[model samples]
Target: MTDQPSTDRLSEARAALATAMALHEQGDLEGAEAGYRAVLALEYRATDVLPLLAGLLGRLSRAEDALIAWEQLLAIAPDHAVALHEKGLTLHWLGRTGEAVAALEQACALDPHNAIAIGNLAVVLADAGRNHAAIGQFRRALALQSDNLHLRHQLRRLGAASVPFWHIPMMNDAPRNDAFEAAITAAIAVAGPDARVLDIGAGSGLLSLIAARAGAQHVVACEMEPLIAEMAQQIVAQNGYADRITVHAKPSTDLAVGVELDVPAQILVSEILSSDLLTEKVLDTFEDAHRRLLAPDALVIPRAATAMGCLVASETLADYAFVGEVSGFDLSPFTDFAQQRLPIHGTMTAWQRLSDDHELVRLDLTQAKHDAVLTRLRIPVTASGRAIGIVQWMHIDLWPGVTFDNHPDRYTDGGWLQILHSFPTPVDVIAGETLDIAVGHDRITLILLPLTQ
Candidate 1:
């Protein structure tokens, strides 16, 4: 009972589709596009033709047209995963990042097992500055497809971009890890097994994990960087410490007594100090934790830190700290704009100590308040040389008996690097003379300058 007109129209539609496919295969994209449009106009198998048409448009660099095709397909089948995924890509191409993320998220949700969809969603999320969420999604996809090199590359890329490069080397530092473990163990031994612990700046969740492994029953940790916090959560879960440790992707100041913690933490373990001490906001972080997050008499790891330094003279370091002339130009004025602080690998660098090590400044972490400190330092010169800067390192008193320092003498491999506090200019001195210099911190950065003549 088929009418001749209907049968003929159907036959014509089939022929048009076959020709369109042949044209597409033969690299005649315009011809293929026309044929595809003609078939769609005939209202024959539009669903099957949509993806092809959209793909061809994309290949032809017609993003707007491709987006329109995907939109039309979505209109027909709202939950179509392919259409949504393609639409997300098109939106991203058009610089509509928000819309792309929304569309890609929808696609990922619809196809939970699709690694491609999940990866694309993660890419868009990262682009939208939702780094934490993006890291989580990428991890989920990577878990499904562990052999995907691209996924691994992206995970490391995001991590490296969001975190400092030294984090990995620091984590790999066995000595540092042992010291922190000993401190955490000591804290737990003193506070007992039921002591509640708070770890601030929980990078890689290592310190928090240490607390958990050390048998702290209840622990709360927080990190301000969303990407780092999210990765920490994964690391904690992977190490099977997720039950004991809860990571808040917020600053320590954002935590509260009864909200983020059931009670004020009884032991506060934090390692947020920079090479110079206060640059990582250690003073602010510890102060805030003491005021709000920690108990009145909470045990603080690394109860004190000392800035240890010795006058150093190096022809090599002088080049890094000062520039006098370049290509016949008196660039001595440029020395005024030289880096006030420079990180140095003391063992690898060519430097001679002009004076023995001395304590430039020290901070008691047990205290809750801090003020700017400035004082005079008298360095007893032993070897006569051009003193370009004061080479400084850290001595952390993690516990009563456990002290650690990255002294330029024996400590060579670790996260800590010797810092050079360059003088306004080089100073000439002889043996048995005292180099009077101003030394201390402005509560944020160390201040070092030789007393000008």
Candidate 2:
């Protein structure tokens, strides 16, 4: 009968499918792909063939094509887990982060047990800087797969990325904290309780709290790091200053006049100075804040900052600066890879000052604008020795009579450690000869270079 012929045709199709699978197993990808396309052309269980085709496309690095294939597969089987997951990954690779996050979130929702989907979602969230949500997703993934090394590493990195190592000790440092508090109180007294206060880089929310305690009625603080911002909020609440302070979890660059603050602040308090003075992008941050966030006559706390340094020679630090011969190899040519300047605890280390304390760099926080700067200077050498590097420190002019500095001679155990601005190599300079040096900041980094005269 005619029915017999139709049955025979079905049998032939099944046999062709079997041959296609066999070829696929034998590494005949092109032939297998052709066979699969043929089978799909017949509309023979296209859903089942979709995954195989998608995989082949992915293997060929045709992510766009694979994405289209997955979209078609998901249309047929809306709950298709693998299609959803693969589409999410492909989208992520294409830099379509928002959509990729949505798709991956759906995959995880469908299969809560899928650790891979959970981890991918967490990673995407972190990439988007939704760290608080990413932290939760990471925790959920870790709960599912407790021994996952990658997940643990991600969590640790996120946690540590927010707070610098100096924050805790800086918060607990009585002398430094007292000096800043006294200065903040004085600033608030001058500006009055009605002064619109803006605290940039609100680490531990300490300065903002001090401003609040000094009778500031309204204070807006910002911390660039989300984790620190969250912690600062908690700390503010704990100290009962939450009513007076408003913490914005964003960088100062993200702040707007009408949105975050009602108007330009009357007083601006920011402590983002690094040990090397300019490395923390302090100059740029302050300049932006002054130009856009502050009133014309805003009282900028620590109105000025200076980078102080002394030329020095040290045998202990020379080993860290140069690498010439190691294991009897002539790697002296590779000494060019050494760090030009290294941050060291000036009081903790022993190095003679070959030059007096000279101002290497200066930043006026009250300035409304800034331009990238570099200057050439001649440092008079006072001692005779193999000069290793320069020992540097910071002096902050908070307010009149309220100043704080980690002088290399006396201050110890605060957030700031005196930095050893090491030279590239041992340069022998005798007394009465001047060392030519270049100093400046590229808005984000401190540049210190020794020039040959």
Best by lDDT: 1
Give lDDT tens digits, candidate 1, residues 1-453. Answer: 233337888999999999999999999999999999998888888789988999999999999999999998888889999899999999999999999999998998889999999999899888988877788889999999999999999988887788887788788889888998999999999999899999988888999998999888888999899878877999999999888999999999889987999999999888888888779888888888888888898999989999999999999989988998899998998889999789988889999999999999999999999888899988899999999989999999999888888898877678888899999899997899999999888888999999964
How many clashing pairs does model 1 include?
0
How many clashing residue pairs appear in each of the predictions shown?
A: 0, 2
Q: What is the lDDT of candidate 2?
A: 0.84
Of candidate 2, the 10-residue stretch with the lowest lDDT total is 1-10
Off by over 4 Å in 1: 1-23, 30-50, 129-131, 143-146, 156-195, 202-218, 223-249, 318-340, 374-386, 422-438, 449-453
Q: What's model 1's overall lDDT? A: 0.90
State the displacement of the C-alpha of residue 176, model 1, in Å, after optimal TM-score superposition.
4.4
> Which segments of candidate 2 are over 4 A away from where they belong?
1-72, 89-102, 108-116, 125-133, 139-153, 325-337, 347-352, 369-382, 431-452
What TM-score does each of the candidates earn? 0.79, 0.77
Q: Among these predicted structures, which one has the highest TM-score? A: 1
Candidate 1 colliding pairs: none
